[model samples]
Target: MQNPATTAFVSDFAELPATASHGPLRIEYRWVNEAAGNAPIAVFLHEGLGSVAMWRDWPQALCERLGMRGLVYSRPGYGLSTPREHAVKWPVDFMTAQARDILPALFGVLDIDMQARKRMWVIGHSDGGSIALLYAALHPDALAGAVVIAPHIFVEDLSVESIAQTKALYETTDLRSKLSRYHSDVDSAFYGWNDIWLNAAFREWRIVDELAAIKQALLAVQGHDDNYGTMAQIDTIGERVPHAQLVKLDACGHSPHRDAPDALNEAIAAFISRQRR
Candidate 1:
């Protein structure tokens, strides 16, 4: 069968009633290599301010290289998905809510049978990385493995500092305008992620305890020069999840897929192959 990733796929939306209380959310997703025959499915999760469009062609490229099927989606309040209620502030456990509630609802709406497709894997970046880790922890039996890029297992001073700087740039520069092209509601997307991270109460936020429950294989990756977080994030994963592999790329920043796509793709392809065997 021909690889779906070779060409662009039209975006489809999934209405999730479980998140209706916050706002009506329709998750935007696209399939890559959908006809790759029973190969393991790799689900792509985007970063804090990321959307399906922001991911560009990286997911498709990676899936094509690995001969795998792919599902790339935008979470609520991102990309072409639902916009957040302007009055609502994301809670500290927002990532938990995403893993436990939003994602499952999305999968059900899309009819992805994790039980039948036991080799399903999650490839996540930044905030999505954390969400993927949380999902693997909560549903250990559902996933084959996970690849987390620049994931945050705990709040860090550097993260807070960089986030604060972003807030400043959003106000003074054209950052908001640039991001508007990707998100329908720029403020909702930006503040929803920014406010919580900058909140003093969030400093205590940590998911290290949750990592111990993840029985599936895991590969934690981060850039050596990542300004948003330090190596401790992946280090903590290795410390907790003894079987987890760590990769630190040199001269790369927060977004490894953008900065070092070739290296990131190779690492993920190899990790998934090893785990599947």
Candidate 2:
């Protein structure tokens, strides 16, 4: 991992106009290889309950390896970004809202021109992976390709069971304390994801139709031992997208970027290089 002291990334904050009754939100973002002039840019989207800080040095490491610029940011309810108001329940289409609304707003604020950029990529993990898929679908011509790690195409029974266990651990264990280290408002991040998943209506959440609309190059990766999802997630993506590639890692779990960083980085770097060529 690159040391923070010598890393070339700059962390900053942007104020984005609120889409609803909440006031303007502050989004925490980091720019990697900002001086790499006109090179392809890869945007890293974190998992549910993830923040810019939670991604640690992975984005920088991957960008450095690929010789590309990177943009990493915390969603509204994560990291130092704006926290959701108290008692606000995320809607069933929360991921859609993010892909269709918040992300475009952020890209505009950051001055990233999707139309002009020839090699723009979206690298997303878990919930972020789902969001990336949604984004690519919504704006098919805007992306060169996408890398989705441990993404969910549909809600699964195992997902609900594991999420339930997580809720138990959050209440009865030190999980909340540990999570507090990564998020400024832990509850805002946690319940925003957790409640939505466990909600009765969320059981019907699925993105298969959205996946069909994505025409860009796609690489879908998941761990063989993932507790949050199964190979079926990526398999279904391939089934729907037709050209999507699937990678399943052994001895890995939901968080492949953490559990298998070297392998994941190599796979993604190679995939991006090929797509660019």
- Give one digit per residue, the lDDT tens place, for model 1 in 130-188: 99999999988888889999999999899999999999999999999888877778899
The TM-score of predicted model 2 comes to: 0.93
- In model 1, the Cα lDDT at residue 24 comes to 59
* Every model's TM-score: 0.94, 0.93
Q: What lDDT is obtained when candidate 1 is compared to the true structure?
A: 0.87
Please count the clashing residue pairs in each candidate, in the order shown: 0, 0
For 168-205, candidate 2 gives per-residue lDDT tens digits of: 99999999988886777788889888999999999999
Cα deviation at 9, candidate 1, in Å, is 6.6
